[model samples]
Target chain A: MDVRRRNNVVVTGPEDGPVLVLAHGFGCDQNMWRLVLPALARRHRVVLFDYVGSGRSEPTAWSEERYSSLAGYAQDVVDVCEELDLRDVAFVGHSVSAMVGVLAAQAAPERFGALVMVAPSPCYIDSDGYRGGFSAEDIDELLASLESNYLGWSAAMAPVIMGNPDRPELGEELTGSFCATDPEMARIFARTTFLSDSRGDLDGVSVPTLVLECAHDAIAPREVGAYVHDRIPGSVLVTLEATGHCPQLSAPQATAAAILRFLEHPR
Target chain B: MCRTEEDPEPREPDGAKDGDRTTDAAFSALLEDSVEELYESAPCGYLSTLMDGTIAKINSTLLEWLGTDRETVVARKRFADLLTVGGRLYHETHFAPLLRMQGRITGVALEMRTGDGGRLPVLVSSVVKHSGDGEPLLIRTTVFDASARRSYEQELLRRQREAEEARRQAEEARRQAEADRARLTEALAALQRSLLPAELPVVPGLETAVHYHTASPDRLGGDFYDLFPLDGKRWAFFLGDVSGKGPRAAAVTSLTRYTLRTAALHDADPAGALGTLNTVLHERYTGDDPRYCTAIFGVLEPDRDTGEVTVRLASGGHPPALVTRADGTAHFLPTPGGLLVGVLPDPHFVTATTVLAPGDTLLLYTDGLTEARTGPDRTDLYGDEALHAFATRLAGPPPGGLVQALTALLDSLGDGVDDDTALLALGVPARPGAM
Candidate 1:
């Protein structure tokens, strides 16, 4: 399949502007960038695409082998860049996609210029000398909660989680509706997102990176933000006063401002 | 009706003023006593926190549950300080942000730490109290005992684990059954191999080859063949097919083989040996369950002076033998009008005599050879016509070459051979001057 159709890529803004690719995280599709896109697209060319099995992307492309690791997802990003002939692209990733962006930048350094990780964590579970702010048991509980609460009536619940303005048409066409993903796909993605360990990949990133951590974020705590910043060489750490895991939805202006400020300064 | 400042007490008289004063006093007393009692003795715990999580006010019920007094909780401890370490982390990350975005959170499960460092599982629900203009003023929270609910969830988790373990054990049992079946197949294969000769004996001035094909490994097929020297000059060989398979058929095959060898040693004639076998089988199986077989027995005598091998073969309800000439022409040496070997009391076995001259080959085989299906739908057999054509394609090669060609033909008929086949080829190699 053509990469644009497979990933459901949507590009908008001025024709000659700098490219900014926005990747949504585990729960939502590209619609997670709905709040930040207006401000972001004003200055730069904004690109939004869904991962396979999410949003308007082709679910048929999903396979257990292709999505067994984050590297496969990084390849999707690179494929999109190659298809569009985009070079030195700015990448904005939320939650798990933050690490996916890191992997993509490492895989094809020429394709990426800057990396922005929102509420990112190198690891989710606590290890020796590391504070990821979650226990294995807590993640299990979260999975159980997702199974019990989401799968039963996912189509109706997705719009609420996406929380976009009244675009019911967009909601109807999504694969299984819940965060624009099949319930089974969401469960697998959740496990892959929460159980991954991308700590070793941090040191290999040569691009300018910004680590955005929200205050009072339960998923990725302040210490995790600090840890990621320290591992990624020459990466800038910015703490948002917005109090949630999804600052783009809760406080769009501040979230966009932090990203814009980071892009303006080189180091 | 307007009352000026001078007449501000126009409506109040001395009797009314006294009555109002007593009612007001009683109402104030009730309000003062009940408010403190309700706040201190509510069924659930109550607490209020500033935006920064510092506890501003706490009720006696909450303080008692935490094993801490009012002095320690109020203004000294933040609301997160009363929670367990993991719960505190959850509160700071997930709960606090959720509350800020949603303006309220309910039914959050957490554990609170007591003064003596014991934990109490509780369900917490909190809301941000807002001023008139929708500004969040303070955090108000309520805690409910969740020990019973926690135990119920634990029970469910245990049952789920038990079910998973049961499924795993069942899968293991299935795997074990498969392994056992594989072992049984191996044992059957060994038994089948034991029924065949370890190696064929070498004959003077003759080239010979034999092949036996089994339809399945689950049960032994009832096809047998043997080639042995009767004396110094003559060799006896037989190929046979029993009517059925498995242990009973295997027993009959063993009996038939020994009877043919013994009878051939004494009789020296191919037809006479088959006659002896028929008589013995008819006598042994006169009971209710009848058993039968089709067989071809042969005597090979090589002529050293003329470089020719004379083959005498007897057929009892078996396919005719094929003699492919030195010139690559093939035809059946027909032995018709013979009865099944083990059925009739006085079965007549017919003998066919042919010479396996230099470069000539004689093929003695069971009907399973010509009866193998060859069509795509498997409705048609590799009949006499096809075998004739196949032998012709061999170009009258020596015994080994013919056997190899037949083996390739059998290999090409995969999933089509429904019965066992035994073939014996005897040929006198072409003389250097004869070619």
Candidate 2:
């Protein structure tokens, strides 16, 4: 497996600068970091890649068994880091990718320098005492919506789904402006991402970490964010003024500033 | 303007003036009251949110459905805050991002948390309103009750799951039926084997070998053969086939086998033994379920002085025997006109006498050998001519070798051999020190 081809790796900035790897969440690909890239790319060597089943990555790399859990996604991240031979890397993850990055860092702690989890939740379902924001029933409804909406997306994305390399026009039709994704891939990825329980993985993190929680985030509520911060030892928790789930897109300046502040101050 | 002069002013009628006054008052009432009435009590809920999902304005009807007043919902709670915990997660992840990217989204299903803590299933549509300078201003949203649609969707999901479960169970049943049939076939196979001799009685001077081939795995075949000693000097051997297959044919096969052995005890002649078997079968099955058999019974008498075997074989509608001589030559010992045994009480049974000296072999078999199918489609038969041709090539092999070679040929025929077959070979070993 060619890691760069599978993840659609894009590397920029000074090669000598400290590496910054950005992993996007479930909905979109690396395009989610477009707003923050401009501000952060100047000072550090920025690295970005799409998960195997998402965005411009090789579509054929998806295997139902391998991708049934988030471990497969973390393996892809580790592959990219290993392929580039980057060490002590600063990793930024948004949404579900935050847990994905955590797993990757845990597998290879020497390669990861620090972790910045943006609006991350270790789990999405509510347990005995934990308030992870959503219920198991809610997740089912979300899966139902995915299936219902996929009827249209599948028709339009059939060509791309078959991985036809000869017809560039059909591929263009699939990867049009927004977060264009294969419907089946999106559905499976959505299930894998939300249904995962990584609360047990938080304590094993050895890297310096920052948990960036936004005000009134629906996907990861204030309590969920705080829960993640409390679980990880010696980790800093920063509450941003930015609202909603995606501050990277909505308030990129504030998001980037918080990240830069964390990077500048080692302690 | 100066000519505004009032020359020729007409007088107004009292009835017309009253009508004009009534129409003017009705138009004024429509303009004044309907606007507020339509905004407050419309069928669907209406609300406007700023870019951050904050609820800026909400109508009375929406407020009433949410069971909350305008002030509590207005600036204090965001539109997303009015949603249930699950709905908020969905709104934040998919709904809001889609609205931001597409500028408008329609028919999005979500549940709003009412003030009474009950959930309201609603279908929402929102459009991002823009300022005149093309800057993003506010998001205007409309909500409709989707309670009925929700219940219908739930019912559909339940039915789909039930259908999948039914299909899974049906597949399991089919597999079970196949397993049961296999077990029954195995039992029938064991029963069929019980009708034949487990081991041949050793003749002092003759080498004997036999093979039985069953065409199907799941049903009992009709072919059976046995070799047993008649006395100290003579041996009785018979190879026969009943008419059909399965349990009924199996019954007839067992009856014929025992009748042959008993008849041979009383008479040393092959023809006399077959006569007894024919009468037994003809008497037992005289009704609608008539059963019949084709058989060849032979008596082998070894001469100790000459080192030769005298074989008298009586054929009853069976294929002729093949004799391979000492000089490596083969020919059919034709018993031309013998009628099938068990079909009639007095069937013609013919005896073909042959001598098996040193290096001579006599092979007896049922018609299953010659009448076996030759091709995959079974369109061609391994007729008497083909068997004759194949036997001539096997002139040098002894009894055991002949049986083994023919079994290999049967295996190569694959699906072509659709009937059960039984073979019995008797070879006289070459005289010691003859070379």
Candidate 3:
């Protein structure tokens, strides 16, 4: 009851290096950032924390509006920056978190130095000019599938999102991870994430952006990565050799190397 | 026609019968076969035509129906000759060409000459049989007694008219229902209007735009948003959706709205105000039909000098706000951990504070935008990511553009939007140089 909700963040890396905040996206929390943490933390002041809804983060705080979009998650970046008084913080977000960072940086421009968006999708529905990869029918079918069997869908959706549905363990682990979390919250979150449209804000990001495109990411396809790259002005796009959505989980070295490379050279 | 007489068994005929017994058997067989014979008494017309419309045969059925003899219809006349003058003309124009192209025409009604000099109705169907060499051959024709079929058709027509009348009535009823639904929606929209601020007060330093899109107009929706003065220098706004529908959910929403405003009035504390609303909802709708809502309650303090407005937001079940800059960039203000308004006693609400600089706009809306049903390829659930992306494009426009775009969006949804939506936007106007 006395939880002030302030001290939950964990920071590592060089004591006086530039602040670099790494945000994990929709399903998993800060733990998902483990792979790239050591590599980034060694050179910069690495900031990591669970979003109020996932990982070790508090679950009771999630709301329909607050967590309805990645923007809230993006604000977490700015909030963390302000709380820690981060200056020129380099933000590296994975999946949706990357998108969240892009918006957050746009909101509080001074707080952000550069953004690295890995395997990001701005919109899931195709418009006249853009192919959002799914049709209205496809999304409805997906929603129906999720509605019918949430747990099964979560397990099934994770690997698909990660672009590694073939691995049985991937499904098992995702289901296990998603199931251990609050199903109701997870359900709403799932609906919110998949139904989001962030294509509008891609151009608004003024800071230098590096969009990391995963070659075989199921959720954020290469085309989507390119889309993000196109909307962002002077945004550098890097295609990773790795496959899968959570490259940090599946292929950390490649993911880390990509982030490091982007940080070293800013557009 | 003459009937063949049958011989009764002769008393001696039985004993004197020939070994074949042919006498009685032949007479009886002949008499019995005559009974089974269909005497095609010319009740209605029957006739046949040659390949060139020449009358080849005619039956008593037609002759009696027409009150005429076979002499008038046989080779002495072509089949068309039996038709009335008007019918013969029709036979040459529309009917003949259709039959030629189709190779068969059936059930054609034509008038025939009666011996009494009266006309009778008849229906004819014809089939043309050709030789193997593709030479035009004879046309076999069948005539039907069409008086009953004509009556039956009339009866069908009458029934169809009645059915059509009934359908029109049903359609009228449906139209009435739609009108009622529209009225209810209009009333509901009116009621919903009373929940939010009619128009946002012009924040001196900001370019503010708010847009709301509810998926449908027929049903009362759950989304609500408002921006009002909290104190002299500060403003409070919150966008949220209440759970459930009807009066119960409306009550929850009303309570949440009032609580946020009053709580903010008391403390102007973003987190504290939302927490107050959450506690009130939990206590009031505590049992049975538990109610909860997601709200993003914000406290915007405009800084006159830098033309920056710092937005302190505490979310309890609401979507994040999109901040659009004058440079035409849009992004969501992150407010991560916020409980749905009514569930927990001490539900967690995450507050992430950020400043929207001059020429930057912040947009807050309910989940209805993201959850809108549209898309050519997918269920167009315009979720958070898409909204942010949408706002991202509106970055360079004035705040009013956001409202305009959203209004248009909500309008497009028509009846698909089952939920009510609320939108509130705050923007720091672009400096003259920036624009």
Chain A superposition TM-score, candidate 2: 0.91
Q: Could you tell me the lDDT of residue B93 within candidate 1?
A: 38
Candidate 2: tens digits of C-alpha lDDT, residues B202-238: 8989999998876656457688888889889989889
| Best of the candidates, lDDT | 2
DockQ of 1: 0.06
What are the per-model DockQ values?
0.06, 0.18, 0.00
The per-prediction i-RMS, to one decimal, reads 6.4, 7.0, 32.2
The best candidate in terms of DockQ? 2
- Segments of candidate 2 deviating more than 4 angstroms: A1-17, A43-45, A52-68, A83-85, A125-130, A134-197, B1-44, B115-118, B130-135, B148-220, B224-238, B247-353, B357-363, B368-435
Segments of candidate 1 deviating more than 4 angstroms: A1-17, A24-35, A49-73, A79-85, A123-200, A214-234, A242-246, A249-251, B1-144, B168-219, B223-244, B247-296, B299-435
Output DockQ, candidate 3: 0.00
Report the Cα lDDT for residue A7, model 2: 88
In candidate 3, how many Å is residue A225 off? 99
Tens digit of lDDT per residue, candidate 3, span A110-139?
A: 888888887788876678988766566544
Give TM per candidate: 0.58, 0.69, 0.35
- Kept native contacts, as fractions per model, are 0.04, 0.20, 0.00
Output the better candidate (1/2) by TM-score: 2
